[model samples]
Target: MTFSIKDDSPLVSVITPSYNCSAYIKETIDTVLDQSYPNWEMIIVDDHSQDDSVQVIQSYEAMDSRIRLIPLANNVGAARARNIAIKEARGDYIAFLDSDDLWLPTKLDEQVEFMKSGNLAFSFTSYSLIDEQGHSLAIEVKAPQTVDYKHLIGNTTIGCLTVMLDRKQIKHIEMPDIQPEDTALWLSLLRNGYQAHGLPKILSKYRIVSNSTSRNKWKAAYRYWKLLRVQEKLNIVEANFYFTKYAYNAYNKSRGLQPVSIQNGGK
Candidate 1:
């Protein structure tokens, strides 16, 4: 399962939407800078952060040419901020990394190799959960080998930070201005005949803060339902069916029942 990435590897545009994540933005930036894959640019879109997040990002950008900062005058939202970055991205591949999230060094290397080897247009990797203080909770969400629109409807395990899309193959893929916008984008691509292959490696770290949307299960469910019924416009029965499966998966992942090794071929 070893792969090699050359110096002239395909350029990866890493997009990050920042919103008052000063506490953890530095480490996040550091993680990206330390990636084993060198041919990449990180666009950290700041959504009018009220803290020192921008300062931290700027400090890093000052040192590294690969790191760029897009500061918004007014606070829009995560989806909109990401869209702005997407519009300006100049790379063969599009990748997402949130401000508070962390990526392991080999993330880009492994994922890019996986996609290139399999001729995959879209792909994601498994990620572990971290607490607000950056302590591992020993919980990892597993990703399936391959998922289409239908499979995604029943199992929404694709993490935004773990996802990498081949823009050369799939074009005009933007995050919708809605709750769970990332998921919406994934579904839209899959619906349009793009299958996302999962690498199943723990290559990213998702930080769970108290105010995180994932913490509010009921609210998250409601927003997901809205995404299905309103944004994507699935029929009531289809929406309910997908929503039910989503709820079950969410419950299981919350309980740490679906560990990374178990889902990723017991690796």
Candidate 2:
């Protein structure tokens, strides 16, 4: 399939927020450099990392003009760093890749084709899990065929590293300064009459770092409930309903079992 259907290929700006990820940052950058799609720029925003992460990223900047680094003066956070990169992004399409994530060679090409052909404004793909040492765990999380605001309230399966958004379709893209900013952003878009379609292809690898935010399931679930009530303004009844469903899916995910599938719709 053709990657860019249009005559003028739209540039895809890959936004990555880095924070003391020196060990895996180089591998992440190499994954982007090896993508089959050519029209892309990788913008790495360092969130005041104390390690050699900045030095490692700087070493790659001289090699390719498409790779650019934005060092923050203060250590804000991942949400703020990603927001800064999004605001400065020059590409028509915005793709997100975390500092430790790895993308397959055809990730961009196939996803771009999928979005263009379906006329989708937002899209996300399934991804496999990897250990800290970059060894595949063979555990893949599949995204639902489609998700709306309410659909996502229960199951937040869209991985940040596997998502791509069309800037022309959604304006004023800013992730909320919350624990799970990516999910909040997707929920905001879906609530604003946008639908996030899922590409079933496993096109990315999510590195499960030890002591990561996601590893803390209890805290994450609490934050998810808070987001539903505070950010989405769901009432007590509505919040309780979705929070229960969210907890169930979280349990399944923790056990390496499939979360509530779209077919089941959390039934």
Candidate 3:
């Protein structure tokens, strides 16, 4: 069930797109470099951070040949920055991690093994939420049984930092120029008849600081609606369906109900 490759093992490329994430960039790099799996390269794309993010990345790049830093002249956004990194990746499989997240030592190894076992084109893993100080926030997401277009509409269960994809399967596709870029990418792949399975293991740490994107619930809701309109090209009825789900989840989350799981059984 392993992916077919000429070499004994295919290289895994890890992409980290950063912007003003200096506070947590070092931990992110350390997590990747400490992985048990060996065949991997880390590509850090800096979106013209006004902070010391570039300097931090450069320092790491100097220490490890496996690390490469690509700095943009101007600040675009995470979606575009990730697209740039994807274009420059040379490995047979591409994995993504945000600058603020950390991967467990076996993150890559376990994911690669599961992908090989399942012959999956792309996959993600469950993750635990951590604060800026690396303290566990006791937040966890139960992995969905499967990932498909229908399940993705109401919620984005796939953690971007935990996702890995076959480079050959999606070489032509690029990240969409939209907020919540990861969601858009997953939708595109699913719409194109590609299947992405999720590993039930919690192999990554998702940092949930006060200023993190997901904390801005209103903005996330808006972006989710915008993504539905932009990518799915859904009519008003379908768009409202998605919006209502997102709004309800946001409301429930604000009230302290465990984050809604985006399962497919709600049809």
Candidate 4:
């Protein structure tokens, strides 16, 4: 499926699945409000957060009509929260950003332009890694020149914060109930022969908190292994090979080797 951009294109829906993310919720909302592109709505789904996340989102919604807050009655996981947000989304395009991440002002503008120009169904941009304090960690990522089912297995090179998709094509596809929902969605798209394009510019900030899930090496490894099994069902050997690399990198990183830069390394 292909789409051409019109001057009166429908607004893009940016879905943010929030849990107990009080620490970074304010900054996340601010970043979305600061987007250079004006034709977008921010749908923030609070997954029954125990923290002040709901209040924060409510305040934002009170200030901007475009920012809508939906409070889930139950504490469902991120996958379910995102699925709910997508179901409620009313836009021609869909974009995702985690509550702990921040987007550069031009993020939506750049990505929307790329998608329209390339006639792409989905696309993602590069991003920089920041510490919990929002300090640059001197880590930046450039996505592969091209992405395929095999290349995505071991490493989730595309940050979830950077992804944008055409709602017309992806609205019917749902995020799987998997450990890593982002990777699962990407795999589904790849399996269905939907190509993903990357704009090699750092358009967002990915926060790495001390107690974040990425820090839990053991759980991460287990999840990677499970994702590998799913990829195996699709007969993707490259996914399995990359999963091994991912596991090794996670282990090495936990031991203090820089996971992003160690050559020929997998966590």
lDDT of 2 by residue, 52-130 (tens): 9999999999888889999998999999999999988999899999999999999999999898899889999999889
Candidates sorted by lDDT, descending order?
A: 2, 1, 3, 4
lDDT of each: 0.86, 0.88, 0.82, 0.79
Question: Cα deviation of 170 in candidate 2 (Å)?
Answer: 0.8
Tens digits of per-residue lDDT, candidate 1, 171-235, equal: 78788888889998998888778888989889999999898886888889888999888877888
Candidate 2: minimum summed lDDT over ten consecutive residues — where? Answer: 258-267
Per-candidate TM vs. native? 0.92, 0.93, 0.90, 0.88
* lDDT digits (tens) for residues 40-59 of candidate 4: 88899999999999998998
RMSD of each: 5.1, 3.3, 4.1, 5.2
lDDT of 4: 0.79
Better of 2 and 3 by lDDT: 2
User: Alpha-carbon error at 52 in model 3, in Å?
Assistant: 1.8
Worst 10 residues of 3 by lDDT: 258-267
Selected candidate, larger lDDT, 1 vs 4: 1
For candidate 1, what's the RMSD?
5.1
Steric clash count of candidate 3: 0
RMSD from true fold, candidate 4: 5.2
Q: Write the per-residue lDDT of candidate 3 for residues 204-260, one digit (tens) a residue.
A: 988878987778978887788888887778878878877777677556534434446
